[model samples]
Target: MIRIELDEAALGATRIAMSPLRDAFCAAHLQLPGRAPSWPYQEWAGHARAVWREDDRLRPLWELFTEGPPGVSDFLMPRPLGTPDVYEELDQLRATDPAFVRAQVAVCYPGMGEEPFLRPYLTDPQAACAALADAYAAWWEEAIAPCWPVMRRLVEDEVLLRARTFATEGVDALFGGLESRARWERPVLELTKYIDAEYAAGERRLVLVPLVFAEGCRLYSTDDPEVLAVSFQARGAAALRERTPGPADGGDRLGLLLGRGRAAVLRELAGPLTTAGLADRLGLAPSTVSEHLSLLAGAGVVTRHRVGRSVYYQLTDTGRSLLALLAGEGVLGTAAA
Candidate 1:
């Protein structure tokens, strides 16, 4: 659970610029999808605002940053936003209310005294705000909205899965050692290939990286699909046993319990095998077999596809990496790394 602190000004600057980028993207394509509210933008902004409002430690820093961009320096905050709901809802909003387009700007950045800069547009303030919407609408129809469906599919199915694995292992185990400055830092880039086979399908246009940060010295966060696993590590606790030399040792503590176990199971099931087939071969309960398969699949150790009712599993090209790592080999080969 690595959490990065963000510069509010940086985020505000980013938020202030988001509409232009979105519009410019749509404009470059030139289709005009019609007037519809963009929920993704709204929610993304909402999250920025939420963090500004909610997170105590980050709030002051963020506020100071938003107060002045130069003061922030080059605050390389992570590009992560909110959950899938943010994107999904944004898409839906765009489809439903074209007028809500300006909401994108208003949601993230604070206006004078709880009033957003977009408030005037909401109440008939005109000019640039309206122009932004019109331009964005054109762009959406031409490029974004059309490609959105498929883009969404990949995010929901694939991105979500890898995020789940990271959520489970990254923080819960990583921090068991001690706290560091990594918390309240910017989110790390989620290597697309690592996220899902069909990763970043549409991200060629927009950068999709994780935001990381720490809370002082004790906690960190890397947002995921469900709950953002913030400060979930067991810092200050007795040190756990070091991971034995194996593929599982690549990551932190959870990797040993999780990575090693999955590696051991997948090692046996390198060849094609059904769930029951695997359970029988491993001599473990069927339920235990299922759990290992889930983790291994997440780690890309194996692939699974439903054949009728029973799902069969096999090693992916990537799974070879896991196996190699476990064998004390380097990435992509069977040589001690």
Candidate 2:
């Protein structure tokens, strides 16, 4: 069991952040033998399977992720403020200290440090770091970037809900309710882990990260003596299913008010979707969806963000309120609810 003893000063220093690459890395763990299946990752697994067949560059990363690497990954997840970024962390990995990299290489593979991919770390640490960075980028482009919007939205929503929990139920209840294995007593929070150890938080802060794809809660201490990071599985994991729009009916207020085509576009925009994705879902041309999206943006109903070459659309607050009202009145059929 791991027990983190936080003093009164450390209690006030607690913070929360979300990581994109961390979730992607953890998703790799699900591909290993004896790992439990999760419903939220089914779509990701399907995509990853298809990508793995086409890309061989990611084999090293997949091999490393399939087994234990206890003290090896601490550098990839540094403690900081606000949302932790994947690209930023990858940059940090590129700049890791050579001595530390050498040490972690031994820790990562132990008896297998002579492996071909890990051999560069023993000879030229800089070259090894660069290769690792390239591998991460390749994996991200193939398996992560395509579905990051959905994962990001889920992580953000979970954080907002936890913040509400901390506000309404007090910090004690919030910590106590975090995971089944975590217990919050007066000055210490204990986690049931395989290895038993104790860490004292004298003055440094504790950073809590909510992860969408973590197998379970894990802890990491930073080079800075002032912060510790705890990554726990984000709530609502099983609910992240495919959100396809239902069959449209013209005998409704939403359809009559916005017209059938625009109404369907708005409904599917309940979650983030690219113009091409929406066109594919609704059986309309990309130009037709783009025209509808432009109109919706002009009317303050949808907001768009460019991810790579594609623009993803999601409902604004006004759009959500409109949908909520429609759903409440049974005008959107059963799918909206």
Candidate 3:
């Protein structure tokens, strides 16, 4: 069990951010020997395995990933500042300070820096950082980038749901509902892990990152006094591998009620998505998606929020109730009464 002590300030500083780099690393970690199967990303793992088998260039990266411990070094998987672009994260990895890299490598690997696979990182941290960045870029492009849109939506939805929980239900409820593997008791959040450890979150930030590939919770903290990052499995990960059922299929009652295209739009809004994202997913023009979104917004079935230059639309409570009723899950007794 690992116990992290959070003061009022630390608790107040807690926030959630999405990390593509962390997801990529977690995906690689999932491929390690003897790890339990992740059904949600099984198909993706098969393709990634084939790439790993055929590509000689990834061998170095693979060695580094598997060499030291059960987890990746915290330096390589820095806590994301916001919704990070993976390419920018690669650049950040490439530009990591040599001294900082060496310090973290020493802590993660301990006395094994002279080994053939680990020597480059300890001897020339800058070159090693660049090489690792190159390896990650190649792996990302080949294995993870194609499926990123769906994965991003899953994480965004998790964040939105948790944020609402924190806002309305207070911190205890928020942490209490995070996952079964974690237990919340006031200022201390206990995590189930293979080892016993303790951390005091003195004035640093605490970040909660949702991983599409995570099977359980993992905690990451560094000696450098940065943020403490906790990653947990996100909801609806199976959708990552499953095919999106076509809205026009005769079995979809929602399609019959709303036009097929509009119903498809509503279903996709289970997670927040931008207009262009919805268009690409549904194979419709952006103009058509915008018109559908406008009507849905006017009807109070969906709501839109502007984040920077992009507008994201998600289902309202009414929209969820409508879906539940159409799917035969909502109880009509209360309404009739």
Candidate 4:
């Protein structure tokens, strides 16, 4: 098992509320507007997935799965499956949990009027948002309030690092090979556009850019009765190697997964297609593509949609953020900072 040492020094370095990349991300995000323009169908699953991953609330679920239990499933997977998310499971697990909910809640820097991204939402600005807008941004904050800090501590490190690095690197060639190799396709401007759309719709969804990767982690399939039961746990970088590297470690072979075929898959559909379509185009099996989609979706890069019989995919708000990061928009901080 790996231990998390809460060093004040490390926290001090990471705790900056408004880092350099945040600014560049905003500017770069201004690029995407009216993407496909309210088409016959809404292929915005990418935006949805991206929003979920980037939010501050997810931190709790992550930390719990990592540091709190013998089997990570105690924090994530359900027993035979009641509900998919673990918000309910926590009530039972809270009593003896070493990394309780309270600590997880701390890492989240509240964005309501605190950060520039949220400043527009704090008041009656030029755009009058709808009630749905008001409901979204504040929901998860309340849900995981008990364990915000734990998640906060672990999240956004790699995300912020990549963001800053993108700023310094050439914007066009920012994310190394994430785009060309991973078929990562998002313009930073698109993210702001989505947020603006939500705000205009009166929906108050909070948008964050924290990148979540299942790399260095295992994938749970529908065939698996129990995910954590069979899966192994990796503690930080060390323990992860002992079992199987987490998706964050690139266990998913994310680079190879992102390729020209993925790009064509999206373009050929005229919108978005199911995982099977993507797989066929990539010259890989459907399951292989699904795995890639999961990683991409988790990283706030791809989008997902459930059609009548199948689920389709696309890029999201966070995907746009990464595009900007890759474009050298916000990579201004020191390498390690």
Candidate 5:
């Protein structure tokens, strides 16, 4: 168990962010031997396995992330900054101090830095950082980028939900509901892990990140006194592989009543999604989705909010209740409800 002691200052400084690089790393970690991805990711894992086998350059990263006899190196876990850009996080990884890298490698690998597979990281940490960054970029492009859109939306929706929980409730409620593996006990947040450790989060920022690929909770902390990050699996991960119900699909009462296009739109709005995203998922024109969204919004079933430049629509309480009632009536699928 790892107990993180958070003072009032630490609690105040706590924030939630998403990290694409961390998602990539967690996905890679799941591909290691003896580790199987969840059922929803079987297809994706097959493709990622092919990429890992074909790319020799990714071997170091693979070993570093997955082949950890002790554990993954903390330095490789980039600090979460709430940015969706993977390149920005990769830049941070590329800029890590050589001495810091060596020190972390020593702690994680323990006297194996000079080994043939790990020599590059210890001998010339700078070059190693650049190489690892390049490797990760390639890995992301080849394996994770194609699926990042849905993944990103899932994580973004999670952050929004968590933010709301933190706002309406308090820190205790927010952390209490984070995950089952983590227990929030007032000033102390206990995380179940492979080793026993403790961290005094005096004034350092506490970053909470959600990953679509993370199977369980992961803690990223060091002696640096900068930030303590905890990453856990995000909700709606199964949606990645779930096929959206079309209007033509039989036994869709919601579709029959709302029209297939509108029903599909409402179903996807379980989490906030943009018109373009809804269109892409439902194979409808953006204008058509906009029409449906406009009607739904006017009917008080869905509400729209603007985040930066994009507008997202989500289901209201009435919408959720309607879905639930329909689900109970055997009209809508459980996923839709």
Candidate 6:
């Protein structure tokens, strides 16, 4: 159990951020054990197999990242943030001192004499950091950037929900909403983990990052014991499996009831998605998807959020109820269930 002692400012400062790098690190778990069954993991597993099948340069890092090891490097995941700025984090990695990087590596992999791959980092930390940054960015571009739109919506929506909870249900409910492993007791926010430790959160910031790939609530802290970082399972995580098609229970009938294209749009929206995303997902023309979206919006079956030039859409309560009924009839997928 890790207990974080929160001050007034720490409590108020708690916020959510999207960490692409953090997600990448979490993806390393694919090489190890304890990976849960999810559509996202299944898709990621395919990608990892294809990417590392050949004698790729990333294969070494992939091997090193396997679980049951003493340690995995933490320099990649800097601090928790209330933003999804990957470039900013890469810049921080570039500016990190060689000694600090080496020190962290040493602490994580204490018996490094046998681990030859990590020797370069110990010998020349600057080059190691540069290499790590490059590797992380390359992996993100290949693995995560393509699906970021869906991933971003999942993280952002959870933050919004938590913010509303904090406002309406007060601080206790806010912590309760984080994860089943976390609970609030007065000044102490306890996280039940394999390890037991505590941090005194004085006049510092406590950043709560909701990561789509995080297996459980984990802690990261700054030099000042008062400042800490907590990354937990984001809400709607199951939706990350957006790439995997849900059960086509009564999809045909639903499509017949609502024109095929419109029904396809609604089915794809088992999770939040954009118009273009819907079109690509359904292999339909963007115009076709847009037209269906317009009709759905007008009919009060979906709600739209226009952010700049892009509009994200989700099922309205009525839409959800409709899907639920269809699901019960075994017409649609598990999305409604």
The parts of candidate 4 lying over 4 Å away from their true place are 1-130, 167-169, 177-208, 211-337
Model 6 C-alpha lDDT per residue in residues 206-239, reported as the tens digit of each score? 7777777776224454442344667788654554
Q: Taking the candidates one at a time, how many backbone clashes does each contain?
A: 42, 1, 0, 50, 0, 6
Off by over 4 Å in 1: 1-131, 172-301, 305-318, 321-337
Better-scoring candidate (lDDT), 3 or 4: 3
Q: Write the per-residue lDDT of candidate 2 for residues 209-266, one digit (tens) a residue.
A: 7887766335455554567777787754543445455446644667878877888888
> Residue 316 deviation, candidate 3, in Å?
3.7
Q: RMSD in Å for candidate 6, one decimal?
A: 5.4
- Cα miss at 12, model 5 (Å)? 1.3
lDDT of each: 0.35, 0.68, 0.76, 0.31, 0.78, 0.66
> Candidate 3: misplaced stretches above 4 Å?
35-37, 156-169, 201-203, 216-219, 242-299, 324-337
- Superposition error at 58 for model 6 (Å): 2.2
Tens-digit per-residue lDDT, 280-326, candidate 3: 56767899999999998999988988876878888788887877777
User: How well is each residue in 1-337 modelled by candidate 4, as lDDT tens digits?
Assistant: 1111222332222221211122111111221232231221122223333443465544433232222322222212222222223333333333323232222222222322344332332342222122212222233333323323222322322233334444455333322322211221222111211112211211111122221122222222111222211111111111111122222423323223454334333232222446654543344577767776676777666677674566666555555454345433342322221
lDDT of 2: 0.68
Models 1 onward score TM values of: 0.28, 0.66, 0.79, 0.20, 0.85, 0.71
CA shift at 80, candidate 1, in angstroms?
Answer: 10
Candidate 6: list runs displaced more than 4 Å. 33-39, 53-55, 63-73, 81-87, 111-115, 164-170, 216-227, 236-337
Best by lDDT: 5
